[model samples]
Target: MFTIAVDFDGTIAYHDWGKTPQFVPGALETLTLWNQQPNIQLVLNTMRSGKYLEEAIWFLETHGIKFVGYNQNPTQQKWTSSPKVYANLYIDDASLGCPVTKPDIFTPGGRPYVDWAKVDQLVSEMVLFVEPIHQD
Candidate 1:
């Protein structure tokens, strides 16, 4: 199985971010499919906290995307005490190495965001994806 960390703002929704979040095309549908994959675990990793966090969470619920954990790996503590969340992949608009496009590429009002089409293709290529559990 693969553990994936996903951001809430521009990755899932549009650049509206803190205010009314507008979803990027195919974001919700892709997440919903990932959630149902038994060999994958989705973790909600984001900078959101307080009220802003609540709004993001609510948005996900309305879209039916379930996550295994939020901001932490539910099963990683058994192997490490580190606070950093361990994930096989991280889907975030602001991720340093992720492919992105300027606001101009998106619809007139769109802002810089992860190119989810590429993301979806990459995620699908790992058909045999798995992670070995380390033991002390």
Candidate 2:
């Protein structure tokens, strides 16, 4: 299965920088669906460390988002000691060409966030959803 590395702050959740970030609208639902799929794997990719990392993990756990790895992948190290997580796609609010919502005061860190609605539509168009065969 292919892997998708998702960012916590600003991507799935709001970008509070230091404080705990809130979940972006529709993010929990979308990620939950992705996690349930059989052909996909998820990895949490973020810059947060120490207690901050724990908080992010706890947030996802509370939200019921299952993931395959965190920060770096175990298999990636066997090939090369790269400090990067191996993923077919990287979803970040800062990614160029990525759709995002307009910055507003209510947003965390007072910054814009990834427009999940648009991202969802784009992802749907990109990935062909094949019906799985049921075994008797």
Candidate 3:
């Protein structure tokens, strides 16, 4: 299976500290698509903790965004105990080479936000090359 680590703030949603930010354009649809793929496992990787983390989880659950793990990969615990979540791909707005749009109304003078449409396309293409993992 291919694991994908996703960021909440700025990546999936607008970066609004202390509150559930609005979903980036196409994020909901793209995430929903990824959730349906049998070969893909999603992990929520973010700096959020405590109440803020709970809020992020609530938002994702309400939106029908499914994830297999959070912060740490459940499948990796058997072999490794590293704090870093292991994923075939890490999707974060802060990462270089990730498609992003110019500053918008939501983020005045802030960094460019992720372009979900592009992300969706890229992920779709990548998924085509990955073979589904089967379990007994």
Q: Name the top lDDT candidate.
A: 3
Global fold similarity of model 3 (TM-score): 0.87
Name the runs in model 2 displaced over 4 angstroms: 130-136
**Model 1 whole-model lDDT (C-alpha atoms):** 0.76
Q: What are the root-mean-square deviations of the candidates from the true structure over C-alphas?
A: 6.9, 5.1, 5.7
Instruction: Give the per-residue lDDT digits (tens) of candidate 1, residues 46-110.
Output: 88888887788888888788887777898998999988889989888887887676776545346
Q: How many times do residue backbones clash in model 2?
A: 0
Candidate scoring better on lDDT of 2 and 3: 3
Model 2: per-residue Cα lDDT over 16-59, one tens digit each: 77676688887887887777778877899988789888889988
Error of 3 at 21 (Å): 2.1
lDDT (tens digit, per residue) of candidate 3 on 1-136: 8899999888888776755468877788778877887888899999898888888898999999988887778999899988889998999998999998887565733656778777776776687853223112
Question: What lDDT is obtained when candidate 2 is compared to the true structure?
Answer: 0.78
Deviation of model 3 at 126, angstroms: 1.9
TM-score of each: 0.83, 0.86, 0.87
Q: What shift in Å separates residue 9 of candidate 1 from its native position after superposition?
A: 1.3
Which residues of candidate 3, in runs, are more than 4 Å off?
A: 106-110, 129-136
Say which prediction, candidate 1 or candidate 3, comes out ahead on TM-score. 3
Candidate number of the best TM-score:
3
